[model samples]
Target: MTRRARGLSLLLLLALIGGLTALLWPAPPPIFQTRTMPLPGVLAARCDEFTPRVEEPAEGVFVAIGYDLANTIVLRTSAGNVVVDPGMDLARAALARDALLARSPGPVLAIIYTHSHIDHVGGARAWISDGPPPQIWATDAFTGHFIKQYEALRAAESRRGEHQFGRSVGPELLPCTALGPTPDLDHAGSTGARMPTHTFSGLQTLRFGDTEIELHEAHGETHDQLFVWIPARSVLLPGDNYYAAFPNLYTIRGTSPRPVRAWIDSLDRMRRLAPEHLIPSHTLPLRGRDTIAAALTDYRDAIAWVLAEVLRGANAGRDVDSLAASIGLPPQLADKPALTELYGQIDWSVRAIYGAELGWFDERPEQLYPQQDAAAREVAMMGGPPALLREVEAALARDEPRWALHLLAKLRAAGSPDPSPELNIRALQTLGEQTHNSNGRAYLLEAAIRLRRPVAPFAVAVDDELRAGLPIDLFFAAMGARLMPERAGAAHESISVHFRDTDDHYVVTVRRGVAEVVRGEPLPGTPTPLASITTDTDTWKRLALEQDSAAWALLGDHLDVDGSLLDLRRFLAYFRRGA
Candidate 1:
């Protein structure tokens, strides 16, 4: 070989070795180490509200505080003991139960769920006794509201909740989850939602033992929410309606439009009750008729003012972003202890209210068809990737991490390979440290870690105990939501499913790009399904949730497939779960 050719080959070999070493080498640690920062004075002071204890708001009324994200209230009466809001999970409920039982050993005559929230009702089974089950009571809309959460929005909400509750971040980052104690991420709890046996609409009164209970439908955070009023005791248990923090007119975790107008109305109703003792499902209890009345009045006015401001701004043709920036409580309301922005902030509530009132259209044609990609390219070309990186660095130095994040996004979208994960991490950490809102703080810090490494989609496994309470229809409905339309391209097939345990039958049809689910048998003119399967509800949940494999279930006789197993596997592949 010629000497020149030999030298070219040697250079190529060196390049190949360098490439392999680069690929194999471990990445260096992040430039900035994330540490838990000290909480601001206001947030630090709020932590005291969540200290675990049991307090009596009135005679014979006991509230187990800080047991979970919610409180458990036990009302002792001559007839028996009444339990209000069992809390988030089995262990916490059991702990609260044991503590309450130690104080009042009377049999629990009734269990009242203020609303259908998991934190309020999941621990109902833990309150069960061998003697007889306590009658569960809730508003008539409870079941429908409960099903809506578990079915359509399940996966998305779970992901958002991880941030909202600071589940993905370290405990030190969140000393208190605003309404409750720092989320116990180390211990997974069992959900025990016992469906309410009795339901009411509008208004209903019940006499349990010697205690007279009035259930009034008060839509606020949830459509099915209700506040419990005991006439004799002059005590009111105002569920999630009146917590110490500003009412979550909009939760960052996401929800259907909360009834802000109705929320204000509900607060008005509480003020009218004139209860000497006011115990909430979250935070500490309030006593004294005058004090409780004043708190309720201020809370109501705060919500009403926010709603009015959003409606006023929206009607005046102002954009949503501008509306959010401009609206906040007046000093009289902002200074009130009951109207703090710990849990929910005014800006988020402003946007939510605006959207709910006027819809997503902002009257701008350019916004109608967002030219984000075109804009990103234009931004990238303005100064190129190097210039953008310098801007990000400068933004970080100026303590403007949010601006740094915006620049980083443009860099990433431009497809630039600027090794700036360290820059991104520092920006996110700075933002998390500076944020006063617990939800935003957690999300920013968690995003920093996720930028450095792959973060798994948060999921809660379907256990046998929890599965029994779930409606079989939810699993099938969720299957449609989990469908991967692209993967199901050009595929049109139907599978008939029968659950022996619940005696429920469903027809799941994957047509082109959508999964359509129909309950019971098919209509007379319906086309014949491609396959049929028989399984118990529990086994189906396990299979659908990917906790158990279809192949294993078929082989173990846990599932009976009438058609080819290969075909069944292909059908299942059309859907995906998690984030």
Candidate 2:
């Protein structure tokens, strides 16, 4: 072949290769970087220094005034004012209210909840004192979502939540970040949460005076999440959808499986909007269409990439632990300010995706029906409790707190009598101080505190207004979860509760330390209840939830008892009343 012809062909091939590489390469990082804000501290010492400051991200949007963790967005529309995700509790709500009142004395016309989380909706009642009770709006599934969490997993969630938020640990011992203001753990549930007056399914567009607002239901952080978009201003209010740090696909505190794919799709939907100003619930807002687009695109790609890697490993027969260790964000994506592991770790995302796709079983026969106390038994065989304690102490002395914690846990589970509670407390304290993850630090410190003293039982305290509105069945289900099997003493007792107000009948049967609630009239063949109690719904709630003395209700004419009073007292004794 001629030299000239061959050179021309080689140039074309080189050009084609360069074009493919450009197309396949990860998008170049955005020219403008998103600003990084200091993490907030919930403890009193650092609370003042780390308290979140309120700022107007856009022309009319104010954020971070109510609480440090959750953002309260106050937008002044043509008609009046719109408040989004009020605050964590009454105090935080008051802070938000004062901040809003200072800027604009106008009344609030509407309150919009991004989701049903307590931090988002707990302060609803605080906003109602002014104005003609602003109309509250939320996703249609919000109420059902709240009920499911409260009824099915309240006990477990409450315990984990206390740890995740560092409620029990002092700031001097364990300094946590991004946890907003410290919440009043005891009075949290007592705070009012106004029910949504208006609910929509998917997309709802409304004209509040001259401004047109669009609400789109997007499932990401929560199943009932909704993002607000104002096309005229090009402002996007994504509640917990696009935060500063990495998205929390799986919270260590334990939560229902979040739909990772749906979460990615939600980000994609926001990216398509090309919002000029993006104000999220947890962090400072971002302005400029190009910047917002790039950030959202990157966020979506990060989540999708992690999920893809996890699925890839799963499909290749890799276990969850292996996937967690192997999968991570590529350098280009990981180094982004918005995608840092401040809140969520990539390892957690891998395990979450793997669990969501393939479920609990890792296709291993040994794990299918493994012995319940396998770890404890194995630890026992390895040298009994004393030996395990000695090893744990040695690990702690060597400055390997994580390893020490693991060994300590196994020692305790193996019924170890050595190392005492004091030693365990010291180890946990060291672990808590050394850990970087806020949730991990909180968990370890809280464990140390529990070892030092008896922790109080978690109380489910619903506001009076909310409690009155809830279905009777929900109340009974919550009560069933609080039953203490040990206190029941193997007695099989059945009690029929007749709610005169609602005309609902429920038979609660306790057998072998398990409590089961059967709705409707008693079965014909079932054993007759030992005691029958007739009460109003309010009285039932007081007895079941508020832990009010049963004698007071009977004397107050709130409850009427038939059959054995002693049997009724015995039945009630099974429940552990919180202080």
Candidate 3:
């Protein structure tokens, strides 16, 4: 126990601790700030519990299939078999049919829908058997949601709309705080169900032989949703009222805001039932009464906690961004398996819930007023896009990448075919290559970098991101991105210019027609052109969008023209239908 001996002992202990730390320490690698191709999806359905296994069906009655993200639920009885929320009818209908057959060979008795989501009801095709058919069930909203499939998809579609939401999640944007269940590949069978045949309101229970089923209607995930509970077995089937992962308070694609308070209360109602097992329509089932109940309780608290924090922060005058960043799960609950951000993030959910309860505006005057176009103002201030590109290039040279990136977006907006003396549409290709955040919007923005989508022959859609996250009404977004509304009022002209390879850069001029090339500036005394243009990228987009006849009038005077009538036809055709 001498001082020198103690010091040596401490050093030995430190070494041991270091070795243990290396073994146990877990942290994600350094974050990447840029977005790239092959963008990410929001959430994968958690099916760890349903790993291919077989248990003898309970005599008299057996529940053959459990629900997952893709399909609905189908249960079996000695007399007959019933299906709920059958999946996509056209594509995977057979798979769902086979799953039901595997469960039991019995007559098709009845069909029910917990709610009327497509996943809940997409597989109606399989229900057509040789015998008496199953009936369909759903809420009144079921019919409306069915008709508005395109609109309802906006929530799921945000997974694709990378550009508008800036969901081009890079390393940094990945959910790093906690990891949810990542499933192994090789899962098969009708874990996915089909659309329902019969829908109802309030609570309805049916006893198929000994099969006692209760379907209760609630509003949270969707407008008309029914959760099923089996009092006999202490097993409850709550539609999306509780996804194994956190329920989405607000989906990113878009939807009417769900009630946060209702969502919390609904989750609470399930916990109190204390089922021996709880089955989610989309995720794995919960085993054991205590575990199932506890998970559901924590879920209730998680929702409540987020809502409380969000409302508290909003009442305290915190802005949306500030509130979003501040609101998160309590640490004790954060580690819970069921409380993870698989389908939904606490931050987005909190902000969305807060906005839903309140309004989007934070009562700030600066947010209300008209705002100048950031691109046009910058282009004019910097003497045009040429100077802007020069500045961006200089930043790149100095290794100021963040600044280069910030400026790149502005330059792109400015270069929208500026047809003036200071025209420059360069820097995009280089920026696209060096970009980060491989999410969907980033890909389109990168494509916007080239003024055209990446050359199709060279670039097949690398992933869904190329088209994902694109506005559902992208014709409108394309108009905005490529438009200069003020100057181009009713000004349409089309002329072909044989852009010649010039001394320094390409020069385009009207050869035989009269049309104005917009978003570009005229350069004096240039011999050859690299690319010819009768109209600029934006004007072409605008006139094409408007289908303005004035475009033909501009073609009357041609400053430059080349190729045959067929080529012109082809060009026009390409403009009408995006390549």
User: Which candidate comes out best when scored by lDDT?
Assistant: 1
TM-score of 3: 0.56
Worst 10 residues of 2 by lDDT: 16-25
Q: After superposition, how far is residue 194 of candidate 1 from its true place, in Å?
A: 2.7
Q: Could you tell me which 10 consecutive residues in candidate 3 have the lowest summed lDDT?
A: 16-25
Q: Is candidate 1 or candidate 2 better by TM-score?
A: 1
- Model 1: per-residue Cα lDDT over 399-465, one tens digit each: 8999999888877776677586899988988888788777777677767766766645434444565
Candidate 1 stretches greater than 4 Å from native: 1-36, 413-418, 457-465, 499-504, 521-526, 535-539, 542-559, 564-566, 577-579
Residues 1-579, model 3: lDDT tens digits: 233332222221111000000000112231234543322332222322433322222332333233222434556665787666554332344555666567667777777766765445545546657788666666655655443423324223423333322222232333211112111111211122333445667777788777787876777788777777778777777777876566677765456777778777667777777788676666556678888778888888888888888888888887888888777788888888676665566777877877787788875677787465867787789887777767776876775655665676676676555432111223332343343222222333423433432221110111122122222222222222222334334433232232132212122222222222323345453323322444333223233223232224244331222333333333232221221
Q: What C-alpha lDDT, on a 0 to 100 scale, does residue 462 get in candidate 2? A: 62
As for TM-score, the candidate ahead, 1 or 3, is 1
Counted clashes in each candidate structure: 0, 1, 73
Ranking of predictions according to lDDT: 1, 2, 3
Q: Using TM-score, give the best candidate's number.
A: 1
Q: List the residue pairs that clash in candidate 1.
A: none
Model 2: per-residue Cα lDDT over 339-420, one tens digit each: 7666777898787888788887877778878888877788968787777778777887897877877776776666655457
Candidate 3 Cα deviation (angstroms), residue 146: 2.0
TM agreement with the true structure for every prediction: 0.87, 0.82, 0.56
